[model samples]
Target: MAIPRPGGGATQVLDRSARTPGRRETESALALAERMPRLILESRRVSSTLAHGIHGRRRAGPGESFWQFRPFVAGEAAARIDWRRSARDDRLYVREREWEATHNIWFWIDRSASMGFSSHLAQGPKVERALVLGFALADALVEGGERTGLLGLTRATASRRIVETMAQALVADDKGQDDDAPPPATPGRFDEAVLISDFLSPPEAVKASVDRLAGRGTRGHLVMIVDPVEETFPFSGQAVLHDLESKLSLNVGDAGAWGEAYRVRIAAHRDRLAEIARTQGWTLTIHRTDRPASEAALRLLTLVAAARGTG
Candidate 1:
């Protein structure tokens, strides 16, 4: 797309030197490899710490319907022993209860160019926060016995090794791309979606994507990642802003003067986004990079719990 230069001079052409097929795939994989270790360690540390505060789903009740049986160990209560099942084996067995149902929650982490935005005022890039938060959520969800998967990358599963699963998906060429929009296909009915991104795309595109998922009967929770610099507009005097995706630059004179107008526009955009999500019966949340990631993770988990009727 051609972007008009600031002050309505001449239109500027974007640099597409690396737009060839597999170019991004290769670069992204290498970058992920270099950063995977740090990401994993940080996510594990955060998730472990959060575990002490967040509560898991309640266990099945004593009178709950039986699902299976396991051999009873020493110190077991006699009243809990399954006599019928024990008769089949020499060892005594205990009845195990099943959950009411299983719900699959899929996570979509945006790897778009804009997600790499970082400023002196922020802790890290938007993508870093998304990965860490996504990992932590997967860690908690799997611990709670919920099926979790990376949307468009793998099938949903209730595996304790979710961190590894996500790492593999992140490095996979076919699964991890900075696509501008999600794949056209929709998720299954009753499935839940967790979309982590900056949501900097055009309003219509964002609306269409959410509408597609909602039409497919998938309830969703959106986590919109924003850098502190983007939200606060801390520039002064003259400044240059660049669009990461289109590679277009806009020069501003007295950028400090433009802060209010910029903030107003962003606020309106967010309000519109929230309205769209509400219309589709989904939830939208904003997370700033400068804040603690645990906060975002907890808020997201609460939303998911409420949606599943477990809260």
Candidate 2:
């Protein structure tokens, strides 16, 4: 995808020899070997920080477990009224059954080139935190008796070896690694989706991807991973802005002055992202790379539970 010339910045094709693929790859085999072990270890550690078994997988529907007994509302449906429970009370009551069923949650973490970005202020690049949070979420969900998998790439699995399985799926993929978003696919009804990305791509494209994945009554979530520099636009004079996805560089003169307008455009972009999620009845959690992964993990867990509860 071509970079939008924000603020009319002058961009040109970068010379191939200056920073070739050999020099630019963040997923170069050596780096993946170093990051994978930590990805697995940190995922388990982060999952351990959150309380387990909270998801009772409960929703109000047809099930064996009794959810609650509520005062029956006047809707003329006497069949739903519990005559036995009503016998003890002046008001008629209705028996509400909790939906007790295992669920499938699929995750998609952006592995595009831009996700490799970082700055001095960030703890690490965006992908590091993305992978950690993704794996951690999968671990937590599996513990809750829900199946989890990599969206569009792997089948849903509740295996005890979830981390290893997820890691292997990513390791085996040698194509479309540079694509900005998850490829479109259809998941089962009542399935949930978790998408982790920087979301720097065009909003229209992102919206389309969300629309497709959320089809068939599937609910989704958006985890926007950001770096400190992207948040603050801390560039100065005589700077070169490189499009990590496209490998095109822009000579935006006086970047310090460009910060204000840049910030405005970015803010608008983020607003669009939030709007997309809101319209779809989905949730959005913004996770900065510098913050604790546990914080986002906990927030996301709560969201998944809330979605099931209210769904």
Candidate 3:
């Protein structure tokens, strides 16, 4: 939703035609290409805050490290049987190697019209925070010997210059990042994902988008980016609010009267989002633009680790 300027103290009053021009969602990736260096620096800075580095997943699959020994099953390859371990027990056993999605961490950041929103109480636009957090997590994942990429947009890579690689991929795509939801991307079964977005879409639409990610058994995390003004409706009196997505303007008479109802509705919306995440066996995190990006990054690292049974 469009933000109205504070008028007469805590109250806000706006003309029906008032429009606060913002960085449009249709902004091209070419512009972002120029900001790559700065954004990269910000991503690196946020990622460096965590002292504990990620390394491997706790699952069993193709890997160099030993994971566990399980009882050998019939029809299994005899070469897989660990003879020495089997001698200690009545049943034959096989050593399983640790499987890591070291090269399968995927990211998707929403760049819709609603995400371009920035209120006076925030550090920058919601889109900016999403980009920063996405890159920051990718940088950290790369540092941990993992590959990261934009879901349905770029291939996963463990490149040291994560921001540059992702930026170049976006530049080539050229299409406007107008989707409020993640693309219909399927991650590897053992893959982990982080979706950065404002997630203001209706719960049904968001659920459909999320299903695309979870369909392939991808362990997903939803990071909901919000503005402080949106979290706390600090406005009162007559005002006009515009819909960033629909671009429709509405006259909000006595904005003060709607404050409680607005908060309740938003709370219900979040509950629905959380429930959808739970049903899909995913996690949800809320990040405010007013806070440090590193906070969300750290939480996500923990979530990914826990999902992989490392934490």
| Model 1 residue 103 distance off true place after TM-score fit, in angstroms | 1.4
Off by over 4 Å in 1: 1-30, 52-55, 58-102
Q: Write candidate 1's Cα lDDT for 76-183 as tens digits.
A: 346657898899879898665554233578888888666665666778767788899999988887676566888778777655678888888777744455585666
Give, for candidate 1, the lowest lDDT window spanning 10 residues: 1-10
Best by TM-score: 2
Q: Give the CA lDDT, 0 to 100, for residue 290 in model 2.
A: 86
Error at 304, model 1, angstroms:
1.1
lDDT value for model 3: 0.71
Q: How far off is residue 230 in model 1, in Å?
A: 0.8
The stretch of ten residues in a row with the least summed lDDT in candidate 3 is 4-13
| Candidate 2, residue 50: lDDT | 76
Residue 155 C-alpha lDDT in model 2 = 78
Backbone clashes under 3 angstroms, per model? 0, 0, 0
Query: Which residue pairs clash in candidate 1?
Result: none
Q: Candidate 3 on 229-305: residue-level lDDT in tens?
A: 87878878877666655555567777887777777877888898899899988999999998999999889988877
Ranking by lDDT: 2, 3, 1
* TM-scores for the candidates: 0.78, 0.79, 0.79
Q: Find the candidate with the highest lDDT and give its number.
A: 2
